[model samples]
Target: YAMTAAHKTLPLGTYVRVHNLENNRSLVVRINDRGPFVRGRIIDLSYTGAKDIGIVGPGTARVEVVALGRRDTSAAGSATTYIQDDYYSGNFTFQVGAFLDRENAERQKRELAKKYKNAHITVYDRGDKIFYRVRVGRFTTLEEAVQQEEILIQDGFPDAILVAE
Candidate 1:
């Protein structure tokens, strides 16, 4: 299937324009999966899209990507953003809450599910303990995240901190 590739960080359904710098070929693809988790890799091209860009044989090529926008298609699908193209502090997000307990993290995630887009819990190890962080929304520009962070703080997420993801 030559639909599209996965994005580890960007929200699914995001519109991304991938430009093959070598061939000067470009394609706009909608993200519908997750991947390219390996370091130094950004997006994984599908066989169809790969064929279009003439890179199926070479397997990999240097490319530049530009995020066009995103449309939420979750079960509660109603949120969207036309995120302007900004290069400053790319992919900044806000961590509204963090808990040492997974249950507490899940609880927050549920509460946010009703009110925010891309609300989810990301588990990670810090020092000797595991922390579950409840994050909300992925923004390309830091200013956008900061605006939401302030709203979250006013709404009682006092610990909301902006993170460059």
Candidate 2:
């Protein structure tokens, strides 16, 4: 069975379980699409399923996933969200940019702040390498991120990629 946490139409053959490492609770789920692409996130459960597994806030989690067989429509407890195709409808605002140097990232952040309203640089140290990420806006969906990337690309920031925050 396929397991995923993103928004896509699911076929009739996927099963997943979210096992919380902290609490040792598990919730069986169906695979509807491909997601939970956020760094360090194992699975993305629906709101109800997340509650059942006891994850409340918005952040990464340590969880184990066990793939079962195909999904049975006649199953007892299945979680579903009626998210329409246009569910990500919103004004695009956020743009995330990756940089190899801290000084260059800071310079870009200052420049963007002069043009736009909100621009910030987040620095992350991965082993001996440091990554500086410049993000704009408080977007709600990947579509919004893609829209903002278009705008940034027009402004000469071509290598930006969308990331969930």
Candidate 3:
């Protein structure tokens, strides 16, 4: 219920300042979930967040977003702490697709595996439903995954994107 938002590309847990260009109101929000997948949208704010910035009634507003580093999720309750975004070394992968059906995900994985090493599926349980995410290759750095993303795109997986696994 704290101010939180969703972004397609920002790393989860990153804090960002959302500035409403229409009303000149701004607020800080944490990136937690994964979308606003519409063609031209950027961020999806919580209901309270939208109301605070005076955009709830019209349902959409032009806003500028500024990343303000990442939140330290490890720390105890309510004591917010932020860490620099520069230092992160973790498992990264290239996600080719996500499917609601397990069989569809498996089919995609099999096809990917024929030409790519480490093609697999990871299940994301979203409480009421599930998603099987098809992914290929695993790397310890973002650069490695990004390089592979381009290859995957060229090879016909146009929606391939780098994801922190």
Candidate 4:
């Protein structure tokens, strides 16, 4: 219920100003999660935030989002300027495969868990269909995840790809 939002490219914890062009309404929101995975949508505002910006009734609206930087709690809650490089530093994992059948995904996860830590299945629902994605490992740094991606690819899962969790 907090005034948080989801954005595909913004770094988590970054603050942004969402301006609804239709109503000329605006609100400040924190990027606390990643999503709006639906194609063509750039941001996903929380219920309270969308209501504040007059976007709840219509569901979606043309909006302009401006990054307002991340809050620096150590410096008296001041905000630090946004940096492009900050996006790469976060939770990451390698997706070994995706399956339409949950059992298939589970089987892959079980096999991966034998040789890897954090092997699990993440479900993605796209309205018409659901996909079970098997992923392995958890790394805070992209470099570390990429290193494992190579190993996973070489081990057998050639299609394994690094994904930010």
- Per-prediction TM-score: 0.47, 0.41, 0.73, 0.53
Global CA lDDT of candidate 4, please? 0.83
What does the lDDT come to for candidate 2?
A: 0.61
Residue-wise C-alpha lDDT for candidate 2, range 33-141, written one tens digit per residue? 4344454454567677777767767454678876554644564666642222332543334445668988888888888888766688777777988888787766766
Instruction: List clashing residue pairs in candidate 1.
Output: none
Q: Please give, for residues 35-131, the per-residue lDDT of candidate 3 as tens digits.
A: 7766468899999899999989999999999888887779888877777675246787777899999999999999989999899998999899999
Error of 2 at 40 (Å): 24
Model 2 is weakest, by summed lDDT over 10 consecutive residues, at: 3-12
lDDT string, candidate 4, 1-165, tens digits: 899999755678889989999989898899998677565688999999999999889999999998877865556445454443455678888777889999999998898899999999999997999999898999988778778877886898766656665
Which residue runs does candidate 2 get wrong by more than 4 Å?
1-96
What residue runs in model 1 are displaced by over 4 Å at the alpha carbon? Answer: 71-165
| Candidate 1 TM-score, C-alpha based | 0.47
List clashing residue pairs in candidate 3.
none
Ranking by TM-score: 3, 4, 1, 2
Candidate 1 achieves a global lDDT of: 0.77
* lDDT (C-alpha, whole model) for all candidates: 0.77, 0.61, 0.85, 0.83
Cα miss at 96, model 3 (Å)? 2.0
Better of 2 and 3 by TM-score: 3
Candidate number with the higher TM-score (3 or 4): 3
For model 3, give the 10-residue run with minimal summed lDDT.
80-89
